[model samples]
Target: MRTIIENATLILPEGILKNGFAVCTDSIISQIGEGPFGKYNDSDMVIDAKGNYVSPGFIDMHTHGAGGHDFMDNTVEAYLGAARTHARYGTTSLVPTTLTSTTEELLNTFTIYEQAKEQNTDGADFLGLHLEGPYFAYNQRGAQDPEYLRNPEPEEYNLILAHGEKHIIRWSMAPELDGALELGRLLRSKGILASLGHTDALYEEVTEAYKNGFTHVTHLYSCMSTITRRNAYRYAGAVEATYMIDDMSVEIIADGIHLPKSLLQYVCKFKSIDNIALCTDSMRAAGMPDGEYILGSRDKGQVVVVEDGVAKLPDRSAFAGSVATADRLVRTMVEVAGISLSDAIKMITRNPARILGVDKTKGSLESGKDADIVIFDSDIAVQTTIVKGKVIYTQNNNLKS
Candidate 1:
């Protein structure tokens, strides 16, 4: 099937172009330009974009769960349910992240990815799995299970690599742990992204790890150490290393609660939109009203209640996860942080796509790229979300499909 979207304002790498027309043939975009359409046949389906903003679909690089479903459960339904909720919010691609768990549990979670990849739900495209635990510093475990936290083990790494079966795209770790650098090297050898997170490593350790192959940072300031003027040591903290390293990409939770609005603005000042990716780090409570929800597996701990956008544990620590969606993240960036709409969109779309190495297929609305696009009104509420040329979500007035 061929479809043509006419009379829309398209967002490109350079800037927004008014009065643009985009044509889609099956799953790939065929043409995008200004002016009259003379080459198309009469049978092609046409959608009047009505001057609305049309851009690449959002990509969530780090998300835990949604719709009362968690990836930690290691179930097919849980994965698909989370994907569906995110898709309705203009996210076309996402990585289902897992919390720290036992080796057996981690493998079980990896097996579920095969099922998610095989099934196509009417939600965001399941790009792959991101393992976010087990190799983290115990002090910065956040919501991860303390019992399961350990130093990197080559045997365990080999087991996961052997069974991952192409669905595992990234792994989050603490670089200061024993054998972590070697594990990072191994992950790089297998073409899997190694992300630094939940660490108390000095700046020198992080920089050395980056040289050894850690090219990404997970949830930049949440579980990482900050630099202080009093502790002017030889090694910089995670925060300092992140700012100094140009090649590394950093993920930030833009829900406003994780990091203060002022702090977020400061971080964005140093990190360009190209190197800073916006992630929800959302849990199962996302898209659901304020209520009780789980972060890690229920067996390891009880579910936390979400009150006023914070997911809190029993001890009353700040929410380790969030309820914000990708659409809301974009709006918050523009409305609160004072970032330009184009830069905010690039954080969710182009930046994440580039980090995941899927830019050619999923990043932008260019010809020959995948037809993953989102349409929204002036207020930025999602009106329609199309993935791979298929309309997965449509909103008409108060009604949704």
Candidate 2:
């Protein structure tokens, strides 16, 4: 099947193409150019984009769940609902994240992930699993279940690897923890992204971990550490170390609430667009009304409240997670961070795809890439989303066939 999207502004790799068009053939992009495509062939479906911006579909690298379902639920229904909910916000692909938990429960969730992928819920594609915790610094555990936090235990990680590392794209841990560098090496050997998060590591510790394979920093500035004074001596923390290391990459929640606009702009200015990726890090409360809910697995999660569209700890001390969708990420980057639309789009699309090592076929609207695309109006509101040449979401209607 072939579908042509015409009369739109396309956000392409080179730059923005005003009044452009793109042709999709089955599951791949066939052509993209400016002006009218001229008289095209028959047996094709044409869409009048009405000058909306056509961009590569947003790719969310970190998202727990949405639509009132948590991925840790270990049910196919929960995975599907989350996928559909994010698709409505232009997330064509996402990494289903897992909170800190016991090995048995984690394995069960991975099994559910395999099942969900095979079923193909027809929303955003589940790229792979992102094992977020069970190996983190107890002091900076943030919303994770602190009771289950511990250092990197070889036995547990070996068991997870035995389950097959192919199903996992990323794992986050505190680099300062004992035996963490060894675990980072092992994860790198298995082609997994070792990210630093929920930690109180200083600049030197982060540097040592980076050399061993911790190449990414998870949810920058959220649960991670920053500069502070000890005995009247200032020292660079994990956050500052990430900025200094050119090879180290980081992902931000970008909900505007997690970090102030000044911080967001500062990161962009220093880190460069290529090093940053936007993530939701959202929980089940996402896409649902404001209320109280659990932050991790339902049976053993921490109590959290959703107020003013953001999730917070029960006592309103720290953020539990974000309720933001992908579109919201883009909007916050543009409106609050004062970045260009093209750069903001790259943070969610091309940058993430590159980090996950799926850029060759997933990120851009270039020819020969997957036909995952999103059309949004000038205000950055998603109007239609196409995944693999099929329409998956539309603003006018709920979801597409």
Top lDDT: which candidate number?
2
Question: Which numbered prediction scores highest in TM-score against the true structure?
Answer: 2
- Alpha carbon lDDT at 4, candidate 1: 81
Clashing pairs in 1: 203-236
Instruction: For residues 105-151, write the lDDT of model 2, one tens digit per residue.
Output: 98888788888998864789999999998888877888888878988
- TM-score of each candidate? 0.95, 0.97
Model 1 has a clash total of 1
Question: What is model 1's C-alpha RMSD?
Answer: 2.3
- For candidate 1, what is the lDDT? 0.85
Residue 331 local lDDT, model 2:
95
**Model 1 per-residue lDDT at 93:** 92
lDDT of each: 0.85, 0.90
Q: How many clashes in each structure?
A: 1, 0
Residue 62 deviation, candidate 1, in Å?
A: 0.4
